[model samples]
Target: MSPYSHDFETLEDSLFAMNIMILISMALPLLNVLGYFLR
Candidate 1:
Protein backbone atom coordinates (compact mmCIF):
# COMPACT_ATOMS: atom_id res chain seq x y z
CA MET A 1 0.00 0.00 0.00
CA SER A 2 1.31 3.41 -0.96
CA PRO A 3 0.72 6.55 1.08
CA TYR A 4 -0.96 8.15 -1.91
CA SER A 5 -3.43 5.30 -2.12
CA HIS A 6 -5.27 6.41 0.97
CA ASP A 7 -4.64 10.10 0.93
CA PHE A 8 -6.56 12.25 3.35
CA GLU A 9 -6.93 15.95 3.23
CA THR A 10 -6.72 18.48 6.04
CA LEU A 11 -7.37 22.16 6.56
CA GLU A 12 -4.02 22.72 8.27
CA ASP A 13 -2.09 23.93 5.30
CA SER A 14 -1.65 27.54 6.39
CA LEU A 15 -3.22 30.14 8.65
CA PHE A 16 -4.29 31.85 5.43
CA ALA A 17 -6.64 28.97 4.52
CA MET A 18 -8.21 29.15 7.98
CA ASN A 19 -8.53 32.90 7.72
CA ILE A 20 -10.06 32.67 4.27
CA MET A 21 -12.62 30.14 5.48
CA ILE A 22 -13.51 32.40 8.35
CA LEU A 23 -13.83 35.33 5.99
CA ILE A 24 -16.06 33.30 3.67
CA SER A 25 -18.25 32.15 6.55
CA MET A 26 -18.77 35.74 7.58
CA ALA A 27 -19.41 37.11 4.11
CA LEU A 28 -23.16 36.54 4.41
CA PRO A 29 -23.44 38.47 7.67
CA LEU A 30 -21.24 41.22 6.34
CA LEU A 31 -23.42 41.56 3.27
CA ASN A 32 -26.53 41.54 5.42
CA VAL A 33 -25.11 44.29 7.54
CA LEU A 34 -24.33 46.34 4.49
CA GLY A 35 -27.82 45.84 3.14
CA TYR A 36 -29.35 46.80 6.46
CA PHE A 37 -27.30 49.94 6.65
CA LEU A 38 -27.99 50.82 3.03
CA ARG A 39 -31.72 50.31 3.49
Candidate 2:
Protein backbone atom coordinates (compact mmCIF):
# COMPACT_ATOMS: atom_id res chain seq x y z
CA MET A 1 0.00 0.00 0.00
CA SER A 2 2.96 2.31 0.48
CA PRO A 3 4.24 4.31 -2.51
CA TYR A 4 7.94 3.62 -1.83
CA SER A 5 7.59 -0.09 -0.98
CA HIS A 6 8.53 -1.35 -4.42
CA ASP A 7 11.66 0.76 -4.60
CA PHE A 8 12.68 -0.31 -1.14
CA GLU A 9 12.24 -3.96 -2.06
CA THR A 10 14.46 -3.57 -5.09
CA LEU A 11 17.10 -1.81 -3.06
CA GLU A 12 17.06 -4.61 -0.48
CA ASP A 13 17.49 -7.24 -3.18
CA SER A 14 20.50 -5.43 -4.61
CA LEU A 15 22.01 -5.02 -1.18
CA PHE A 16 21.56 -8.71 -0.47
CA ALA A 17 23.27 -9.57 -3.76
CA MET A 18 26.14 -7.24 -3.00
CA ASN A 19 26.62 -8.82 0.38
CA ILE A 20 26.76 -12.29 -1.19
CA MET A 21 29.34 -11.17 -3.73
CA ILE A 22 31.46 -9.53 -1.05
CA LEU A 23 31.33 -12.63 1.11
CA ILE A 24 32.37 -14.86 -1.75
CA SER A 25 35.24 -12.55 -2.63
CA MET A 26 36.48 -12.57 0.95
CA ALA A 27 36.01 -16.33 1.35
CA LEU A 28 37.97 -17.26 -1.78
CA PRO A 29 41.18 -15.72 -0.53
CA LEU A 30 40.68 -17.20 2.90
CA LEU A 31 40.17 -20.65 1.40
CA ASN A 32 43.32 -20.30 -0.70
CA VAL A 33 45.36 -19.41 2.33
CA LEU A 34 43.91 -22.31 4.28
CA GLY A 35 44.66 -24.73 1.50
CA TYR A 36 48.24 -23.55 1.29
CA PHE A 37 48.77 -23.94 5.00
CA LEU A 38 47.02 -27.31 5.15
CA ARG A 39 49.08 -28.67 2.27
Candidate 3:
Protein backbone atom coordinates (compact mmCIF):
# COMPACT_ATOMS: atom_id res chain seq x y z
CA MET A 1 0.00 0.00 0.00
CA SER A 2 1.09 3.53 -0.65
CA PRO A 3 2.01 5.87 2.18
CA TYR A 4 -0.44 8.48 0.88
CA SER A 5 -3.35 6.05 1.13
CA HIS A 6 -2.24 5.03 4.61
CA ASP A 7 -2.18 8.63 5.70
CA PHE A 8 -5.64 9.18 4.30
CA GLU A 9 -6.98 6.17 6.14
CA THR A 10 -5.53 7.42 9.40
CA LEU A 11 -7.05 10.83 8.81
CA GLU A 12 -10.45 9.29 8.19
CA ASP A 13 -10.22 7.22 11.36
CA SER A 14 -9.26 10.23 13.43
CA LEU A 15 -12.09 12.28 11.97
CA PHE A 16 -14.56 9.53 12.81
CA ALA A 17 -13.25 9.36 16.36
CA MET A 18 -13.49 13.15 16.71
CA ASN A 19 -17.10 13.09 15.54
CA ILE A 20 -17.98 10.47 18.12
CA MET A 21 -16.32 12.48 20.86
CA ILE A 22 -18.24 15.59 19.84
CA LEU A 23 -21.52 13.67 19.90
CA ILE A 24 -20.82 12.32 23.36
CA SER A 25 -19.84 15.72 24.67
CA MET A 26 -23.07 17.20 23.32
CA ALA A 27 -25.20 14.38 24.72
CA LEU A 28 -23.70 14.40 28.18
CA PRO A 29 -25.06 17.79 29.11
CA LEU A 30 -28.52 16.92 27.87
CA LEU A 31 -28.38 13.69 29.80
CA ASN A 32 -27.47 15.53 32.97
CA VAL A 33 -30.44 17.84 32.58
CA LEU A 34 -32.75 14.88 32.04
CA GLY A 35 -31.40 13.14 35.08
CA TYR A 36 -31.91 16.21 37.19
CA PHE A 37 -35.52 16.49 36.07
CA LEU A 38 -36.17 12.80 36.76
CA ARG A 39 -34.66 12.92 40.21
For candidate 3, write residues 1-39 as lDDT tens digits: 999999999999999999999999999999999999999
**1-39 per-residue lDDT for model 1 (tens digits):** 666544533334556688998998889899999999999
lDDT of all predictions: 0.75, 0.97, 1.00
* Candidate 1 overall lDDT versus native: 0.75
In lDDT terms, which candidate is top?
3
Model 3 lDDT at residue 22: 100
- Candidate 1 clash pair list: none
Q: Candidates sorted by lDDT, descending order? A: 3, 2, 1
Question: Model 1: runs farther than 4 Å from truth?
Answer: 1-22
Could you tell me the lDDT of residue 33 within candidate 3? 100
Angstrom error of the Cα, residue 33, model 1: value is: 0.3
Model 3 bad stretches (over 4 Å): none
Per-candidate clashes come to: 0, 0, 0
**How many pairs in model 2 have backbone atoms within 3 A of each other, for residues 3 or more apart or on separate chains, i.e. clashes?**
0
The local lDDT score (0 to 100) that residue 27 gets in candidate 2 is 100
